[model samples]
Target chain A: MGDFDFSIIAANWRFLAEGLRYTVQVTLTAMVGGILLGTLLALMRLASLWPLRWLAAAYINFFRSVPLVQVILAVYLILPLLLQFLTGRLIPIGADNSAYFTFTIFEAAYYAEIIRSGIQSIPRGQVAAGYALGFTYSQTMRLVVLPQAFRNMLPVLLTQTIVLFQDVSLVYAIGATDFFGAADKITQRDLRPVEMYTTVAVVYFVLCFALSRLVKYLQSRIAIIR
Target chain B: MNYHWDWLFFFQEADDGLMYYQWVLSGLGWTVAVSLTSLAIALLLGSAFGVLRTTPNRWLIAIGDTYVDVFRNIPLIVQLFLWFFVLPELVPRDIGLWMKQDLPYFVTAVIGLGLFTGARIAEQVKAGINSLSRGQRFAGLALGFTEWQTYRYVRLPMAYRIVLPALTSEAMNVYKNSAVTYSVGILELYFQYKQIIEKTSQVLEITIVITLAYFVVAFATNRLFAWIEQRSRVPGMIAGGQGGK
Candidate 1:
């Protein structure tokens, strides 16, 4: 309805910068943590032991089935109590810390599935060859299978990271001042809801769009010829 | 550490004569309705744009790409806020006023969610179509079918079957993403959880119940799609294997 103004955002650049920093921090942290935990889950899901497989399956299924907002809320509330019980000391954890923990655990479920499929996509002969080479089971997975699987799944992993970036905004529900939350605060303070929201939306779009392009480039580069 | 769990709190009557479970159930209803309605919009528009992207026309592809890039990149929460607060002001004055004052929150949530998810679905639909061999499209054309008719009779049917697994995941994603509507003041399941937590101070219990409710919905959706995928499988056509968030 009116000409857009970027001055409001420029004036609050520091707040926006801090929010952006937090967003990037949480996203990268969750990506690493999620992938690490997810790889373990993926390994467990594929384990020879039925119990380990079932446990891994159950964890993935439960987390994947529930909405992530609930997970964030649950973690935000339950984690402190959990830590208190474990350590016999009350630890006051902030929403930001809980958001970090929640996203790591929650995203691990998704990454587990992707990694499982990635591992599965490797030819069975590769595992056989590793065994023929007298490699231990763990070494076969670590040194032989995993290297190929990572290449196969790199694009999907990066795509999921883009999604993780978008989901970082949900931390706002827990009162963590991530990018979206900071924008909302500016909206409240400046009485410029439209400009604040639009600016944040554009920022998110640019970040995600760039990441998606990266995913595309990786996909083309690593595409295996059948 | 001394917090007591009150599982029976859900049965307690509120000031409005409805029990907490009733509130939760109503919220679940809205969640289901909003997700389904928006999913319908997403699939319809997504398929149209997807088809346009696959067409020979450059302009159509550009339009499709623009829609996907713009909608797919922005966070759903931001989009919902835009729909709820900003979209009205951008429209014509009278219509904008009507939208601001008279349009229901539910409708606004659907528009926001539908368009956001639609962008994602458009990409999936485009991928589905492209996965097919070019020979299939040429076959349809050689059989004297018009381009649209060729797509209708040959390409789309095969593409839909091929992409059933991906589509299943997208369907579940839409349902999960609907939770973002809580930001726009829609009393979906997540919002109900917030209300219960605020009223009873039973954050843990309420979180567990809502989490279970969401799980049930998502699990049921997954099963439904899996069933469809099984029934619709074409013998020679390779299934697009499961897994996408």
Candidate 2:
């Protein structure tokens, strides 16, 4: 520890910030994509035909069962090969653009189940009341039930977002030069693995701690009795 | 056909792809080993945290809160990298060098999974404990049970029953996250698939194998947990109307 130089991090602040921007972009894109996909699956799982419900279940189970690393790896590595075999030419790729796509697809699986549980937590009576008022099932879900379900889900949803923020680091596995990747590169180049990695870890720790605190604050403000 | 699906290529010794499938089996073994070890570690720490959260002590509650918050927010892979690569570098020079040379991959994988999944199990366990009535605790006290005894007998069983589903999900998550071990070169299932895909360009076949492996493991594990949940139901809870078939 005493032998480690702390000043390298100060020197690399701009590079770190660039990495942070990419991390933030990936996190935001994946979260939004995950929520939309999640909501659709939630609705399908609830009142859709048996086949649709099974399909929804299978999607969640498959995604959640496999490791996110596997999912990310498959998208970046294996999918291209499979596609190249079908098509005449291989897909051209840019690092960040391809990375964002992989992250969204990877995160969508868990988020779908989270949303489904949130919807399931809603009372059956409320849906029946909406129907009694002559609202179609979709209309009732959209107008009344989903809003309440979202409220019920807000705390867990926030927690999931924080998880997503953390998961953005995994993009480094596929060559995206995100914050963690930058730190790893620094470690490799400078032979100061401890200093570089610790600097990044502290940065990650501060961000995650702040996010969890924010979630708690939000939960208190919008406390649901149930 | 420009792209013939040579399924027979996989079964022949002349084809250089058989080694990749063997790697997948080894990777699967590592995944299972890491999952089981981490599950044990997570359960122990989580149960202690669960007890603390329900205790009358304020500081203990704060400690549990801090633990869960810190670990839950960070990505598991970052944690793994920090544990395997960085932590060793920061320790005493002699000890650090020794660790870098000697630390087992399985040990690192378990620590990674345990720390991440423990935070989740702690939340589930605390929720389980809170769902029980105040009267149950009082009843244990009235029956002359010690604090530890009360926990061992009255509190934990019901709490386990209450949080069975959540624990099952966490178990699955830990199993899935174990694949992150590949980045540190743990050679888990995904690692095997990557090697296979790279070697023979049988990307679809190997990808399908990994997917099927996960599905089979998950389904069997879920069924096992469901059976445990059924068996662990409180006497009247299942025999009476509350339990679903």
Candidate 3:
């Protein structure tokens, strides 16, 4: 209790910052890729055809129910093997590069639901009005419905992104050095569990807390826009 | 790497006197234990904090809001690591020793998962309470109920009904999130998967089995919650005006 050292964090702040860079990278990749893929899936779930609906539902349900750590592990092991079989050699996405696509694929399920709700929130008459104005199906979705849905879904999407950012820490299971994993490595080498874990926790708390506040603010502003 | 499927590996015995299938079951048993115990804690704390958030007093609401914000914002993996590693060091000397040496990993995982999930449930419960019409509160007051009494009787019951639908997802999340405990060294399903993979060539098979195990638990949870939701339907009330869900 007497000699808590703040100097370890200061000494290794650059290393930790590098890890934070990777964390933010994975998060942004997942966010952008997930939203695009999720929007497509959401449309499939709402498609008039039964097979599209079932396929989307099945994909969404399986991902939603499984533990993300397991998914990460699955990616670590199986993805390389899959690429090997597919391309005649392991294309070597390895644990680190794999984390990017792994998260994007997994998070698409959650984003699908959010995007589905967002798409649903748009009035049917808006789509009908688009069609009436000589718009095709994709045109209405691209021009009128999706933009409005994106705005309506912004806060929820951001909230889930906050969650995805927290989840990016789980790549530690595969020995990838995201922010949390970076702290873990430092803790291992320095034998400073207290300093390392506490710093990591504090950083996460601050980042997530700030994002949540932004969500609240945006939520109010978005609500007023309608 | 050439892949071969060996489904029969599940029937083989490990040195611990349990077969692979039984080991899988034991893993499942632990997963269920973690999920249920944490869920119990989450509901108790969640309801408390949620009610506090909805209270007319600013202090109470702030207290609840702070709790939710602190817990929810941090990842479960970090919280588990903190409770398992840092907390034991932070406590008083003797208690810290006990935590380090004597305390069970399972208990630590449960506490970590519980507090984390409780924060989420508190948000759900707060939303449930706030979504109620002002008339419900007025009716409780009109019935001569005090603030606490009103919450205990009128507001809570209907509020819980409204939130039941949402709680199903939370219930599933608790189970899914229990997998995070593997980082803290609990012998849950994922831990079992690691153990089995080390001993077998059926990595894909066992992975599939683990995925199925989770799917099965989730399926059962969904069915159970659906049954409860149906049975608890207030008949022209639960859907907030429409017929039963």
Error of 1 at B25 (Å): 0.5
lDDT of 3: 0.91
Q: Candidate 2 lDDT, tens digit per residue, B77-175?
A: 778878888888777889888778887877877877788888889999999899889998999989999877888999888888888888888887777
lDDT value, residue A96 of candidate 2: 66
The lDDT of each candidate is: 0.88, 0.78, 0.91
Q: Count the backbone clashes (under 3 Å) in each candidate.
A: 0, 0, 0
Which portions of model 1 show Cα errors greater than 4 Å?
Answer: A224-226, B230-245
lDDT of 1 by residue, B1-245 (tens): 76689999999997789999999999899889998999999998899999999999999999999999999788788888888878776778899899988989888889889898888888888998998889989999999999999789998987887777777778887768888889888898988888888789887788878888887787788888787777767666457343322
Q: On a 0 to 1 TM-score scale, where does candidate 2 land against the true structure?
A: 0.90
The list of candidate 3 runs beyond 4 A from truth reads B238-245
Across A133-206, the per-residue lDDT of candidate 3 in tens digits comes to 99999999999999999999999999999999999999988899999999999999998889989999999999
What are the TM-scores, per candidate, against the unseen true structure?
A: 0.95, 0.90, 0.97
Q: Judged by lDDT, which candidate is best?
A: 3
| DockQ-based CAPRI category assigned to the predicted complex of candidate 3 | medium
TM accuracy, model 1: 0.95
Preferred candidate (TM-score higher): 2 or 3: 3
State the lDDT of candidate 2 residue by residue for A1-226, as single tens digits. Answer: 6776768988887888888899999889988988888888877777559998888888776677776766776777655665667686787665667778877776777777777888888888999999999999889999879998898888888788878888878777677789988887777887777777777777888988887788888888778566
Specify the CAPRI tier of model 1: medium
